[model samples]
Each structure stands twice: as structure tokens, then as C-alpha cells.
Target: MMGGLSIQKQRRLIVFAFITVPLLLLLTFAYYPALELIRLSFTDWNGISAEKNFIGWANFKEVFSNPEIFGVFKNNVAYFVVGIVQNIAAIYFAVVLNGKLRGKNLFRLLLFLPYILNGVAVAYLFGYVYDTTNGSLNYMLGQLGFDKLSETSWLGNTSIVNYSLASIGFWRFMGFNMVIYLAALQSIPNDLYEAASIDGANGWQKFIYITLPNIYKIIELNLFLTVTGALEVFDLPFVLTRGGPAGASETFVLKIVETAFQFNNYGLASAMSVVLLLFVIIILSVQRYLLRGKGE
Candidate 1:
């Protein structure tokens, strides 16, 4: 069909066709559903209902006024704070593993193993680990002579339940961040470090001046991802605690699920989902702007 066309025009046509098909599919599948979700947020529709009543802003008003909603966001904030600690731990592991150490590849593989497991499997595994009676953690504590802590309810107590859940996120994802940072670390030029060493710069000084500056972009990217993951966390908390004992571990996404599936409040759930999406967009936009400004 393109026999009469110039070679350049044929290549351009091929490229356009390749791009247009995926772009069209993306708009059809992804963006269309997203637009529908926004539309649903403005109406009162039980998921089963054929008729949806247009109730402008009512769902939003209810979501904002609910006391439980505030607690859900509070849990999200707690998760985000814990994620910062997780990022720091990942950086430490990455820095150490990037060195000329024996068995580093094996160690990296082991650390990253948990992240590749199914979320449901990880949840069940950790559930057993955190179980109050006859759990591995309690048994270990007993063996270590901390018998008092052996009987402590790790997932049942409100005071520590959020922390317990957050720890799972740390364990599962820290290796992912470590691998990213490790890649960044390996890409740093050895000449920079060599030059620093000749100038009598110590390990800490070299890290501060040469290593940190070179990998700052990757660091920012990891931090942004951590924040977003923390905000959207649902699976582990849902499978392990069901956002309980008494909603102690309730996250925003879990709340959205419960609202839509359990209570049949599709409109309210949609509203909450839109709000969460907007919150993430605004946060990421601010982060991108700040990073770009710093780069400039």
C-alpha cells in the first residue's frame, strides 16, 4: 500500500500507526473509566441500581464531615511517616550492598524476594508472624527472655496496630527502593571518588559531596513513589486486619472498599476515590515542581 511513498514517509507512517493504536487503547480503557468514575461521584447510585439520582456535592459533603474519614487520612499520614524511615533503611542497605562485599548479590536477592510474592500470600504470612498466641514473633520473644512482650497483641491493639501494619510495608518494599538506589550508586563515576580520596576527603565527606549530589534525582523519585504507595496502601491491611480490631488499621483505600462493597454506597466511595486521586495529584505536582526548581 505504501509502494509509491518515499522511505522517510513510510517510516513516519509506521511510527504514527504504532503510537496511535496504544494511545487510542489507553484513552478507551484507562481514561474513559476514570472519567466515568468522576461522573459517578456526583450521583447517588447503589452499585446495583439501574437508576442513578444526580445529587451534586452531597457525597462530598458527607465524606468531608464524617469523623471516620479523618481517622482514615490520619492512618495514611502515619503510613507516609513510616515510609520515610523505610526509605532511609533502604538507602543504608543500598549503600552497603553497592560495596565490594561477598555474597552481596545473594543478599540483595533475599531482601527483594518478599516484594515479588503475591500480596495475599505476604499478608497471610505476616498474619501468622504477628499472631498473639503461638506466633513466631511471640515465641522468639519468649526465647529471648522478654516473656512479657511474648503475649502482647501486635495486631489487636489500637495504640500499636498502625505501626505493625506500617512495618509490613517497610519489609515488603524497602528492598525495591534499595535496588533502585543501588543502581544509582553503581552509575556514579569512580573518578569522582578517586579525586576526592587524593584530596584527603574521608568516606563521609565523599558521600556528602560526590555520592549524594549525583543520586539526588533517584532519591527524590524513590521518595515520591514511597509517599504514593503509602497513601494507596490497602492489600496487607485489608487481608491481615480487615481494617480492625475495631478499625485501628483502617486505611483510606480499605475504607473506600468497605463503603462501596459492603455498604453499597457507591456514590460516597466514588467521591472518596476522587478526593484521594486529587490529593495524590496535588502532592506529586508540588514535589515535581520543587525538584525541577532545585535542578534549575
Candidate 2:
């Protein structure tokens, strides 16, 4: 008004002012860090060093060429498998909970309680559960007449260690996924189900046609999140196994942390991070393409 600006122009100026602050914050905190990661990927900066020598493609080349380095993906594959199973279970439970049930609220609370619990505490709790000498799991198994199985090392043995850690991830996240699925399921129009039922559509048919179609987006979103989380799994392995048993349960992200901190190779860690970012982007793109195609 002092500048004799029109009301529309004044409103636009206000909107721009409001938008600018958050945009600047996002650029500073999120985008800047991401771009820095990309920049660091091309250099040999040992985190604390004054010199950041540009190494071109050498870090990426070594990441691929080193079989021992790339083999940690197998551990991720185990988590991905568990994530897939977790997604299925989540959806199944969500569907069931969406329907009428006795003590539904209690069950829902119980199912979601673990997701809200402290992750570090859960990891520590499982450590005791999987302990060799006096763990409750072993005691219970032995009591149930599985002495040989109870004697097995849940986190020590290389063969099943990844799966053991993967189970922790599965348990930790399934309830959250179920809550997502439950919300998506509840959002669907019940009228659609009623119409399908009136047209002689059974539960399976209604689910296949109406439910799946309505919730397909949520399903894809869950799968994307689950797969990405699986690829980035680090906490359980870090806290429980420390990626031990000769690196049998190390995750890609854990490897990145190890390279940057433990091994003092920031360039390689950044390159690994860049690779993981690219891989996640590719996966997200492919999933959207396939899901959009199927939707059509």
C-alpha cells in the first residue's frame, strides 16, 4: 500500500514472502546436504582431511569390482524378502481389522504398540532374547522339545544370521505398515463393495476388483517404502551383530558408515551413497511405470 501496489500484487508479495522462508530452509538443510554428498562422491576426502582430492570414477569402479564389497547386497536381499512377507502380513491384518471384530481396538493397539516403541530399546531387548546362554527364546525352545534348534546361534552363525536380523526388522515395522494399509482400506467407499456384492461378487472377487483397484496406490507406496528400507537396513545389524560373522549380515548402509567412519574412506562412502540413491530412484521409477501400466 505504501508503494501503491495493487491488492493482488500485495497478496502475491505476501505469498512469496511466506513461501520463501520454508523454501530456503529446505534448500539449506535438505537439498544442500544432498548436493554436497554428490560433490563429495567425486573426491577423496577422509572426513577430517583438509584436502579433498578429486578421484573421478575410481571409487565407483572399486565398489563394483570388489566382490567382497558388493556381496553385502545378499544380506539386503534377505531383508527385502522379509519385507515382502511383512507387507503381505500387514495387508492381511489390515483387511481383517477393517472388518468387524471383538476387542478390535485392543488388537489394533497391540499390533501398533511395537512400532511406536523405542527402536534402540527394541534392539537391546532382542539382544537378550537371542543371547546364547540364558535367552528366553532358547529356554522356551528347549522346553518345547527343540534342544538342537535351541542350541543354534541366532546371531553368530553366518548362514541364518541375516534372516535372524531381518526378523527383527519385520517385527519392528509390520504394525506401522498395517496401520497404513488399514487407513487406506477404511478410506475405500463401502458403496463399491455393496454394489459388487449385489452383483453376485464374492469376497475374493470384490477384493480382487474393487479393493485392490482402490488401494493399489497405497500398496505400491508400501512396497516402495519397504524395499527402500530393506536396502538401507543398518540398525539391527549394527546394534546386534555389528555386521559380524565375517560380514555376513552387514547392510549396504552399514557398509557406507563403516567406510566413512571405521575405514576413513569418505570418497568411497559417498560413492556408495550415490549408487544407493541412484538404485532407489531406478526402483521407484520402474515400480511407478509398472503400477501405472497395470492401473491402465
Candidate 3:
């Protein structure tokens, strides 16, 4: 069919074919499933049932009316707050590592190592660290003479359990965020900093004017990712606490899983999923608008 086509046209056709095939596959596998999930949210199906009765807004109504749902959302908000702290810490470390420091590469490697570990493994590892009696943390507190903290149950205490889980998230992800910020820092032109220094700009002033401006977009991107990940956090919390100790650490995504698999309320779970998705979309849209306004 391409026998009469020019050579450049033939090359373009080949490239288009390569792109089109994967695009089709992505639509078929990824988008199709997502659309089906949305459709399922409006029905009454136990996932194992042969009949899926259309229930209009009933599932959404149930989700909105449930009081427990608010608590799950509050936990998600706490996760997002902790994620903000993680990004701040990551940026600080990235700035320090980008400086004239020794063993920077080694430090970066050590920090990033946790991010590559399996989530389940990390969860179990932290589970031991948070054990009430035998955990390393309490043991260290004992050695430090803070005997009172040594007996405290890290994961069992309702007041601080969510913070404890959020700390694990920080530890696991701070390094990854640091690496991203480091890359962004390196991309910033050195000449800009030199120019600022020549004008007698102090370290803090230079950071505010040059560093922050240059990496603002990267920071926005990271915030978007952090917020989405925060809202959808599941694996670590699931494995570590099973959303237990009086459901103090249950995340929104974990609640969805519990409702669907444990409670066999597949339709309700789907409705929750859709609500979460819409919430994410709205938040991201606001973030985009703010970033655009700042850029302008």
C-alpha cells in the first residue's frame, strides 16, 4: 500500500503506526476499565452477582450520609498535611545536598534506598519499629532516659496513631521527593545565582528570588502528586495497622477496600472511588489555576 509513497511519508507512517498501536492498547485496557468503574458506581452489584440494577444516585447518597465516611476523609486530610511536611523536608535536604557538601551522593543514595523497597516490606518493618513493648523506637527512648515514652504504644494510641503512620509515609517518600527536587535544583542556571550574589544578595534572599522562582513549577508538580497519593494511600496503612486500633489510621482508599471486599458492598465501594476521583479532579483544577495565576 505504501509502494507509491515518498520515503519521508513512509517513515512518518511507520512512526504513526508505532504510536497508534500503544494508544489503542492504552484506551482498551486503561480507559475502558476506568469507564466501567464509573458505570459500576451507579449500580447495585455485589461484584459476584449476575444482576447489576441501576440505582441512580442511591449509592452516592449512602456514601454522603454515612458518618464514618467523614472520619475517613479527615484521615486523608491528615495524610495531605503530612505530605506537605514531607515535601518541605525534601526541599530543605535537596538544597543542602545540592551545596558544597561532602558525601552528597552517598547521602542521597542512603535516603532514596527506602523508596525503592517494597511497600509491604516497609510496612512490616515499621510495624516492628512501632511495637508497644519490643520496638526499637521505645527501646531507644529507654536508653535516652525518656522511660515514659518507652512504654507508649506507637500504633495503638488513638491520638497519635495517624501521625505515626504519616511519619512512615514521610520516611519512605522524603528521599524520592528529595531526588526530584535535586534534579530541579540542578536544572536551574548557575549564572542566575552568580548574578544575584554579585548584587550582594544574601543566601536567604537568593533562595527566595532565584531558587524558589526557578523551581516553583516543580514544586507545584510534586504537591499535586503528593495530594493525590495522600488521598489514595492504602498499602502501608493496610499492612501496618489494617486500619485498626479503633480505625484511627484508616485511609479513604483503605475504607473503600474494606467496604468492597470485607463488607461485600461493591457498589458502595465504587461510589466512594468515584467521589474520591472527583475530589482529586477538583483539587487539581484549583492547583492548576493557582499555578497559572502565579506564573502570569
lDDT of candidate 1 over 1-296, digit per residue (tens):
99999999999999999999999999999999899999999999999989999999999998889989745888777788889999899888988998889999999999999789888888899899999997999999999999899999999998888888888888888898899989999999899989999999998998888888888998888888888888899998888889888887899999999999999999999999999899889989999987885522
Query: Which candidate model has the greater lDDT, 1 or 3?
Result: 3
Which sections of candidate 2 miss by over 4 Å? Answer: 1-10
Candidate 3 C-alpha RMSD relative to the actual structure: 1.7
Clashes of 2: 0
lDDT of 3: 0.90
Cα deviation at 105, candidate 1, in Å, is 1.4
TM match of model 2 to true structure: 0.94
Candidate 1 clash pair list: none
Worst 10 residues of 1 by lDDT: 287-296
Runs off by more than 4 Å, candidate 1 = 1-9
CA RMSD (A), model 2: 2.0
Judge candidate 3 at residue 258 and give its lDDT: 94
lDDT of candidate 3 over 129-190, digit per residue (tens): 99988899999999999999999998888778888888898999999999999999999899
Give the per-residue Cα lDDT of candidate 3 at 197: 89
The lDDT of each candidate is 0.89, 0.90, 0.90
